[model samples]
Target: MTTATRVPADPWPAPRASGPVRAVVRVPGSKSGTNRALILAAAADGVSRLRGALRSRDTLLMAGALRTLGVGVDTEPSPGATGADWVVRGGLGHGDGGPVAVDCGNAGTVARFTPALAALTRADTRFDGDPQMRERPLTPLLDALRQLGAVIDGDAMPFTIHGKGRVPGGSVTVDASGSSQLISGLLLAAPGYDRGVEVSHVGGRLPSGPYLDMTVTDLRAAGATVEATPASTGRPPVWRVAPGPLRAHDRAIEPDLNSAAPFLAAAVATGGEVLIPDWPEVTTQPGRMLPALLEQMGAHAERTPAGMRVRAGDGLHGLDADLGDVGEAAPVLTALAVLADSPSRLRGIAHLRLHETDRLAALADQLGRLGADITVTEDGLAIRPAPLRGARLDPLADHRLAMTYAVVGLAVPGVTVDDIATTGKTVPEFPAMWAAMLAGPHLASDNTG
Candidate 1:
């Protein structure tokens, strides 16, 4: 079993920080990239090897879903704390057995992407997820499938895809303002459509362009032709994926820069230094916005030979910025904003409500308990520099929320985060990494543990 350091069965008393952070932390592979690669690989025609794929609950759940679709995904147990490598024999065609069934487990990617692949087969494929996923939006993607001539029953999760073993893939438009998953879901499985796929958005604005960029980059690398209209052109974004067979190839996943936010935020909050090595010099990961965003907020960040390094400035400052393109960093930025000398206003992430949880509401409610004067707005949240007191924080079973609250505990006392186990969703090594960061390794373990 490739479990992460054997976590406790009960809620972890989150490790607290005593002083400025000084450590070299290695984050795992990108879940976004891994899940996308898995879908594309499953749709391909040959064997593919994916090295450095994240082995967390989310990515594993994606692998399981692909397995249900009759794709062969073989993973080697991770050795020495690194991510596992996957040997996937690609043949998305139906096996000699019965039809498929996928359990999304609240993973937005699986719930959204797999149905598109199922539409390529004439089998009766069932798609469902946890109760919360049933609440999130999947109608946009489902509507697009219906437009492409796939007979789908039900609007969201707990639905069935009655594929006629052929999709008359062509032009289809859907409003993806709620989440970019809808856009990506269509593009990934488009190659299998008999005529390929052409998707246009009919929404106010797309939420995460970088994520789609990652999708396009991966798709084109796998030999699929993709054309995307510039969103700045005033017309809604349009994507054209030509009909072709995806060429299976080897992929080396990059470290999840988004998951690295909190650990790097440790240095920013305490005027210390932290190094995250293997940082990609050029990549589509949205966390690439860090070098500039942190710099704008009173920190010196640069790409070093070791990795991305950040040194705390004279002190953390505040800035008003629109985080529409890179919304995942909002929670990490909000935690730092509460400690800034000046107030901070984070805008352009209204779609975050449709995430694993209502992030804006959860942030407002949980951070409020920490004595932060935070206001949850329709698009985002506004936080003022207020005297914060350590209070019981509820993670709402969201991994990002748990990681964000843990960073806030570095400056505040008596901050206890409920559902620390939820961090396993993306970063199962979170507890050990947090512990190592606080104790400074060669130091004592109980400093925060």
Candidate 2:
């Protein structure tokens, strides 16, 4: 496989071994929440204003997709609005029955969700994306949509979506091993169908299953009826949603706990403490495991009313754990494991290989570049802590890998990450955020623990 060769201008920060890195940082809006809110707002009846919305590439792509489907999305200053909020004037369905092509970039959410919404319209629209996105599978979602009477152009990425304008939703089986996006897509668009969609799983286990809950919760909040059945071996879990008009409710997007993991992990690896303000106490994000996992590694992780506090221990221990649910945070966690006192084995992450890049291999290759002892397997990674002699790191066109390795740079000297701009896919102000956190006082000496 080809690797990213371009070196980043503002590469890894200088390694600091004995200082406390303590600062209270406010995380950006959740990418998952923003995408769902935007889509739900687009399907709502009246104007829906979303606050603290993430203005990243993925959400921006979703916004652009909404506009193509006749939704009026205004980002400019609106009368009596606080902060940089987006005012989405809803009630605009797909118009003119014309062919509209959407370039979702590398956003799988956009690629999956937009097609289902597009199928709800009578418009003959084609959904396309970058080469990587085109390579990603959408056959499961397409098959389910086809079962609902929506005409799809073969089993391809740049396929045409000949919308039936009215979907005859019924029961269909989908393989969610590839992605949970397939399930989320069907759930989001199923509400508007004449006979709401009922989906069942076919093969392999579902990864990131909690994300599907987020989708259902968001849909229910938007006034859609959805019920999920228990999962059984060899039988797909069933989901039933009733056809109805979505309610126009003012919703607050949750803070991204997953996005906050790398910073917390950075604190654990570098003998510092980082505070993330406004982290939700009740969140389904699998990345919430960071605090517990860090504690297991001999760090102190405390959750206060304000937010979360993470402090590094004298010595960190390696952990053998299965992270199938919160697999998105695996790369950074594995990077942090490289600083532990022993070897760490992270299993049940095979789903990660299907993301924007082959995450498992990408993490292994990049960490190996930094002199880390990493072994990439079909299931997951086995990482042994070593004195990571910083080397030029390649981000493999993956945003998570780029951002995760940047955290590795805080504690390792000479670590450089290429294609840093790829972080715009999720966190827009990455290097800036790192710089801000680094300017704070070190937490190792501050015995506030």
Candidate 3:
């Protein structure tokens, strides 16, 4: 049996203050959208191509899993060789091959989404992950699939997904206490089943609701019929997707506003100016609420067709907001609260505990080490903004925590984030991108020209 080990945090010392910092940055593509698009494209009938897909560990794992299922996947540089594009030939069927093992490499998205996609194939495939991935729960999704006649091994990582050829899709009530990915996975795999699939929530409150919307949107874009209904007494909210042959469509993934939130928070916390290009003005992404929250805290934010423009205020103030829909942004938002002049309270984040790490505890523990007043409640965090005394931060092996604390370091000198390499799992160019963005006046001057 392989035991799970915590990845040691690598400390990143506070960046040396250069002159006035300003830059227009093109944030990386959305990992969420890219993975969803990849899976949808893989399940579609014809060829679907994606431009500016995030080439991170998680997306790579999805691509590799698709390849194992016999999907023709290719990567080609755009005409100018500036950005990469993916060409995917979809239409998956049962392979006569033996059990295919997939290594998701700490990507909860790929780990959860793949099982449903794998069920579409007649082959027996096993989904496993790195130590961290194993620690994450797959029971909710597995239970839902099992209810639909898919044979899945319960209580194990690297569990076998026995495809019984075709699943009779019917109504399933999924307990989303663990992760919304459970619901998202079932919804993505629903279209390929024999009968239409109807998923309803069971017990726990659904966190990350926007992410589920992203799934529904992508599923519809791939020519699947999906209808979302409100929750009733006995039945949970129902998401119905009809079984059909999927058609291919070229998809351009939206910008990763979740990834961009930290940088935008850094700009607000440190009294700096930063612009994230290609950000969608209207987005279901919970991260889009940052601009309004930042403005509420006295930061200046303007929305342009190009993207979002953010400038820090004279001083930051505390805010109390319900973040159930956008739990992913909770860490960075919590980091922002650390620099506020007053105590900030963030609620409706109980689901944060089940992510890549126990984000609520991890955030409070690490931020407390920096001499900030933080408390992790059952539902969310309460933070008192004060001058954070620079200290070594333990990121607890979570990519979001590591990256979020790095933003904290921008305002508090001498702060360092440990286990920094884990950032590569989601944002590969983190250090270099941060360094280049923080190059201060050099980047600012270039952007001005």
Query: Which candidate's TM-score is highest?
Result: 1
Q: What clash pairs does model 3 have?
A: 9-418, 9-419, 10-417, 10-418, 10-419, 11-417, 11-418, 12-417
Predicted candidate 3 versus true structure: per-residue lDDT over 1-449, tens digit per residue: 12255555446775743543466667777889888988888888889989877777777888898898778888877553223578999987655664788888778888888888777777788888887678787887888888887888755587988765678878888888678888899888888888868888877788888888889988888889999987777767879999997888997767788888877877787777778888886666767877888887778998887679888788888889898988878888888888788888999998777777788888887788888898988799999865568888877667899888888877778888777876776787788878877864333435565
Task: Kindly list the per-residue Cα lDDT of model 2 for residues 1-449, writing each as its tens digit.
Answer: 33334445765443444455776666787889888888888888888888777788998999998888778887744233222467787764546667887888889999988888888776788888877787776888888888888888979788888766677788888998989889988888887778898998878878888889888888888888889997876566889999888866666666677888878887887777888877788876666777888887889988887678988888778988888888888888887788788999998899888888888888887788888899987789999877778787778778888878877777777877767888888887877777777776444436655
**Which residue segments of model 3 deviate by more than 4 Å?**
1-10, 16-20, 79-83, 232-235, 440-449
Q: Per-residue lDDT for 135 in model 2?
A: 71
| Predicted candidate 1 versus true structure: per-residue lDDT over 77-161, tens digit per residue | 6566469988788878555434678889878998988899887765788888777778788998998999998999898779998
- Give the number of the best model, judged by lDDT: 1
Against the true structure, candidate 1 reaches a TM-score of: 0.94
Write down the RMSD of candidate 2 (Cα, Å).
2.6
Q: Lowest summed lDDT over 10 consecutive residues: which window, candidate 3?
A: 440-449
Off by over 4 Å in 1: 1-11, 77-81, 96-99, 232-234, 441-449
Can you give the TM-score per candidate against the true fold? Answer: 0.94, 0.93, 0.94
**Model 3, residue 12: displacement in angstroms?**
2.5
lDDT of each: 0.86, 0.80, 0.80
How far is 327's C-alpha from truth in model 3 (Å)? 1.2
- The C-alpha local distance difference test score for the whole of candidate 3 amounts to 0.80
